[model samples]
Target chain A: MRTKRTNWLATCFLIAGSVFLLFPLYMTFMLSIKDNKEIADSVLAFPKVWRWENFITAAEKVNYWQKFKNSSIITVLTVTFTLFTNSFVAYAIKKKFDHKFFKGLYFYFISAMFVPFPIIMLPVVKLTARLGLDNLYGLILLYIVYGLSFNVLLYVGYLRSLPQELDEAAIVDGASVWQTFWKIIFPLLAPINATVAIITTVWAWNDFLLPLIMLDQESQTTLPLAQFIFQSKFGQDTNLAFASYLMAMAPLLIVYILAQKWIISGVTRGAVK
Target chain B: MKKNNFGIYLLLVLPATILFFIFHTIPAVMGIFYSFTDWNGLKPTYKMVGFINYLNVFKDKDVLDAYLFTFKFAILTTVIVNVVSLCIALALNSNIKLKNFFKGLYFMPYILSMLIVAYIFNYFFANFWIDIMGYLGIEKWMVNPLGNEKGAWLAIVFVTVWQSAAFNTVLYLAGLQTISEDLYEASALDGANKWKEFWGITFPMIAPFFTINMVLSLKGFLQVFDQVLALTGGGPFGVTRSIALLIYKNGFSGNEFAYQSANAVIYFVVIVAISLIQLRYLQKREMNL
Candidate 1:
């Protein structure tokens, strides 16, 4: 009887928590479809009109496709480069963990995990501008570089758990180190790669500050940057702002819903490590 | 054979190393170097001021207020998030129906952009919250929280906790799964009450995770930016201005590049110190347990 009561209590608590957690998202969806007069009538009311044109109008106003393209390019390139470069470096460090140089390199990469981004923000901006890297590609390059510490940590830790014998066997089969890693080792890293990719995708897709600082041109803006500037410029249009927000977040929300389990487990796995 | 191995190692690592060096290492070094100088970020030449900027960081009221606000925000969010998430984790770890569904629903907010989340909540505070409060006859909350100095910081904390607690709950859930069910059963058999069981069994088991959540949350919150930027823009008399936002504003807009770099360096030191202290204390407690 006690166990049943407790279970009932837990369920109630969880439902309430979920409502609170999701209220803003619910409101966003509701407001996105409501005109300003309807919004002023009742903030909580379901829209009688269901104005889907809010989304169309928002997309056109923000040049949604262009920003979407920029975001996709940056996120895709950043995730891809991060996976290859960080894993390649981790593999080398794992293979040569016995060497002082490699061990020092490992520590060098890991130490960066402690440094906050703001500390390096100004100088990095200065350097990037000086190097003519103040653009989307530069932002992608920075993500790949900044990702080294955490991604390398994850990869090296996972790599250590896999036996060295696999690499040796591949090498014995006339495979070069590169071939051995790509063929035998990299494939074995599917789980960690998923975790890395999920984490990187969420970060790169949602990040606003890096793009805000790097990409000065209006045409170079990512979805988040564009939405930010849009809201500030069109501060009075709550309905349109919410519509733009909904559209901006729609891709990530769809992806999350589709791969809910993978994302949850991936995030959990990343954190617990 | 050794020479060949060295070549392979270079081949694999040097590209990443060069990128890390150029972007990460050089910038960090430059940040430190410039923190001591009077460089305004535009001029090519400036004299090294030898810790003058760091000295000004202590004397400057805005910088000091930013540190205080940031620390307060970090501490409040860290405690609230950890406690709330731990409770949610405990409830989820109990015998509940639709556990996976609830878990997925709760974790949804975390994947959304912080800027977007902040914007959504900005509207909530400005409109929905006021309406709800008016309906409830709560005159205090009838006005927009983001426009009040005290309410603005609390609102930021509330929103941060809302999104961040989900992630921590997931962490705590992972920790909860590691415990043997037999231990709980044994504790129950010993006539331990729920509170006793939690303190005696669950808390200790999840202490390591408690440490991880606390440290990570504190470190992240100490550098709070996007929420403040999107919601308050460090307004209501700049009471909600975080060190990170202050650094950005001062460095970029205010053109106090060298001074903000110094502040940034100090902020970096504070984060490292706090994290180290938390880890040491928490890990020690874990060991004692």
Candidate 2:
């Protein structure tokens, strides 16, 4: 009898929580299909006419394809740069465990993690302008700066888990430090690499503040900026705005869909560790 | 072989290293320099008035509010998400059917961006749940919690907790699985009730997982920006504003460059300090497994 009551309570809690999670998604879908007139009147009611072309119209208005290309470059390059640097830095620190520089480098990198971006973002923006990198290359450099520390920490944590005998064996076999890292160490570190890449990719892709502040020039705007402009300019028109949002999310949503399993496991594992 | 290999190793790290030195480390050094100066964030032509901006930030009330508000959100969300996730975790730990599907459904929110979630919740407040309430004939409970000051803070806390609880649920569930069944058997033999068994055995076993959850949630809550920006824009009188949003707005949006840098420096110090305190407190209190 107690178990039966417990089951009922579980069902109630599960259903309520599920509804809480799903309500917004369902509303977004509903608003996308509904016109502004319908939305103003009521968002809960079923759409009398589905605006199938809302997405198409938004895509056209926002230059969705162009933004997608920009986002792809940013995410791909940022992930590659971030992961490589983080792992190398991690490897260097790990190697320096017996050397005098270990403590200094470790403290410098860890302390870097606590330096909030606001303190540095302005200086970097000015510095980027000065360096003539006030475009894609500029933004990419900004990503590397902010992204490297966390990646390094993740790599350090991961590298610590690995045995040091691998390095010793490579050193004995005429494999230099670089050869050992690239040929043997990097191959064995695939799972950690995957974790680092996926996390950094999502961070780079979803970032809005950096792009908003840095990519102020319209030609340099990423997808989020493009989507923001679309939504704000025509937010009253539920169809066009919703379409833009859906369009903006499509690439990320699709990519995440493909890697959800790995991401979920990776994220859960990260937390556990 | 040695010369070539050493060169290649450096080459392997060159692209990333150069980017980091230019973008991150250099700017960080410059920020400390700028904080001590009165260079209005943008003007290339300005005097280097030393220590004044930092002095002004110390006297600012809104900056303090931003710090307090951020701490409030972090504490409330951490407590709520952990509790709610623990309950859900326990449910799944039991003989619940459709467990995997339910887990997936719960986790769907985690993948969406905060901007999207914020707007989605705005729609929920203005339209969806109210209609559901109207349909159920309980319209009194449909008041929008995201509008008023205190109520809005609570609503954001709840929303953050709702969106994140599933992931915590997964963590605790994983933690629960690691516990030996023999512990429960031993508890049963001790004439203990289920409640007693859980508190004495179950909770202690998951203490480390609890610490992990606390830290992760604290990080997420403290850095909350997109949702607040999208939903309220820290509106209805800057009541919902967090330190991060305040820093972003002042530093970038308002162009109070020197002032904002000082603000950010203070904000960063508070987060580091509070987290250190929490860590120390938690360390002293955590039950041994």
| Chain A TM per prediction | 0.96, 0.91
Candidate with top DockQ is 1
DockQ of 2: 0.41
- At residue A137, give the lDDT of candidate 2: 68
Model 1, residue A3: distance off in Å is 6.1
* B54-97: candidate 2 lDDT, tens digit per residue: 88887888887777778888888899999999998887776666
lDDT of 1 at B40: 90
Docking class of 2: acceptable
Give residue B231's error in model 1 in angstroms: 1.1
Provide the lowest-lDDT 10-residue window in model 1 chain B: B1-10
lDDT of 1 by residue, B237-278 (tens): 999999999989989989799999999999889889989999
Location of the lowest summed lDDT over 10 successive residues in candidate 2 chain A: A1-10
Docking class of 1: medium
Task: Give candidate 1's TM-score.
Answer: 0.96
Superposed Cα deviation of residue A102, candidate 2 (Å)? 2.7
State each model's CA lDDT, in order.
0.89, 0.73
